[model samples]
Target chain A: GAGVSQSPSNKVTEKGKDVELRCDPISGHTALYWYRQSLGQGLEFLIYFQGNSAPDKSGLPSDRFSAERTGGSVSTLTIQRTQQEDSAVYLCASSPGLGPITQYFGPGTRLTVL
Target chain B: GESVGLHLPTLSVQEGDNSIINCAYSNSASDYFIWYKQESGKGPQFIIDIRSNMDKRQGQRVTVLLNKTVKHLSLQIAATQPGDSAVYFCAENLHSGGGADGLTFGKGTHLIIQP
Candidate 1:
């Protein structure tokens, strides 16, 4: 079985630039989630998408963070005007459906804002 | 705000010994709990999960215990191996009326297995 996948395993960008991270969830998975992990820190919830329902953006730290899942399969997390504080690993996960299901994670994309 | 927290930042155990990690959550509304293992340079991998109804659940060589009264959760690994060394996280899920919310993760405990 194929697991969740992410692109650009490592990305180094200049401050104020925008970066988009992509996630491809497992086939047939209806629930997707995004999280951020800073160096030596715990994971922070970012956004969530389930099927066609309204996405949960409550965890997005600021207006600069946004995400969208097209056709209920793939998701893209975009960070506008990236800052040094945005340097961290962006992780994506997906589950079979929703409640109490296990989320399979992708190898995160490490963004380094220089 | 409600949160989940780990009792220890790191635990060192010898190979073949048992290891236990503890977590305390403040949100009683959280009905589901899970444990994840993250190795360096990789994303978190689901280890096991336990629901609010049951007090304990067992998986291959692993057991998850939940205490709703004390809002406590513990993960026990039998005969811990060197390959088990990683940062372990405890996450809680709050099922909002509308839909499921993102999990609230606790600061992980680094498990160090000494051979």
Candidate 2:
């Protein structure tokens, strides 16, 4: 079975620039989540989507961060006016919404704000 | 500060030895706990999980223990191997009203194996 996938394995951008990261969840997965990991830090919850009903944007660090999941399959996280402190690895994970709480993750996109 | 945080970021142990990784989580409302292993340049893989109701649960060679009194969770790997060398993360699902609530993770502990 195909696992979750993310694009732009690595990204380098200047401060104040905007970047969009993509995530492709496994087939039939109804749950998708986005997280951020900074150096020597833990995974910070960003947003989550379940069957496209008003994604949970509670974890977004600031107003500049936003995400959208379409057709309950793919998700994109957009960081507007990125800051140097926003440099970190962005992780995406997905799981089935029925029984267990196990989440399959994707190789994150490392964003470097210079 | 009551958040998930690791006491040690790096731990080195010899092969065949038992490994213990510790984590402290705040928010006593966290009833669900999970352990994830992340290798270099890869996403996290689920290792094991335990609910707050149970104090201990075992899976294969890994065991997860939860102490609600102290708000502590630990993962013990029996007969550790080189393949087990990676970063271990402890995450908690804060029981909220929203569907598909997010998980709060602790700073990961990087496990190193000595041959």
Candidate 3:
């Protein structure tokens, strides 16, 4: 079975620029999540989407971070006016449903703020 | 804020030995926990999981032990191999969450295998 996939494995952008990262979840998976991993640190939860309900943005860190899942299959994480601190690896994961289920993660998109 | 944390930043184990990684979580309300392994330049891979109802669970060569009373968790790997060299993370479902209450992950322990 095909695993979750993300686009633009590497992205280098200047400060103040906006970058959008994309994620494609596995077929029929109803739960999707996004996390950020900084250098030498654990992954930080960013957002979560389940079915057609509202998305969870509790860990967005700032208003500059936002995400949207279209048709409950593909998701896009957009960061507005990027900052140096925004440089990290953005990973996407999807699961069969929720609650204790395993989340299969994508390769991740490394965002470098230059 | 309640969070999950690891006891060590790194651990070195010889081949064919058992490796144990420890974690402490502050959120006693958390009911589920998971262990994930991440190699260089890749996303985390789910290793195993355990629920609050059960104190222990085993998967293949990995075992997850959870002590809710003390708010601790541990991952034990038997017969460590070179392929086992990676960063191991412990994650918990905050507020029994999966829908919106995202998970909390520990800093991770980088396991170094010695031959």
Which candidate has the highest DockQ of all?
Answer: 1
C-alpha lDDT values of all predictions: 0.92, 0.88, 0.91
Q: Which TM-score values does chain B get in all models?
A: 0.96, 0.95, 0.94
Report the first chain's TM-score for all candidates: 0.96, 0.94, 0.96
Output DockQ, candidate 1: 0.69
Give the per-residue lDDT of model 2 (tens digit) for A53-78: 54456678899998988998989999
Model 3: per-residue Cα lDDT over A18-114, one tens digit each:
9999999999999899999999999898888887454467779899998998898999999999999999999999998877777889999999998
Model 1 segments beyond 4 Å from truth? none
* Model 2 interface CAPRI class: medium
What would the per-residue lDDT of candidate 2 be over residues B35-106, giving only the tens digit for each residue?
999998888898998888899999999999999999999999999999999999999886566554778888
Stretches of candidate 3 off by over 4 Å are B95-99
Better of 1 and 3 by lDDT: 1
List residue ranges in candidate 2 displaced over 4 A.
A98-100
Q: Distance (Å) between predicted and true CA of B67, model 1? A: 0.8
Superposed Cα deviation of residue B8, candidate 1 (Å): 0.3
Which candidate has the top score in TM-score? 1
Clashes of each: 0, 0, 0
Q: After superposition, how far is residue A67 of candidate 2 from its true place, in Å?
A: 0.6
Better of 1 and 3 by TM-score: 1
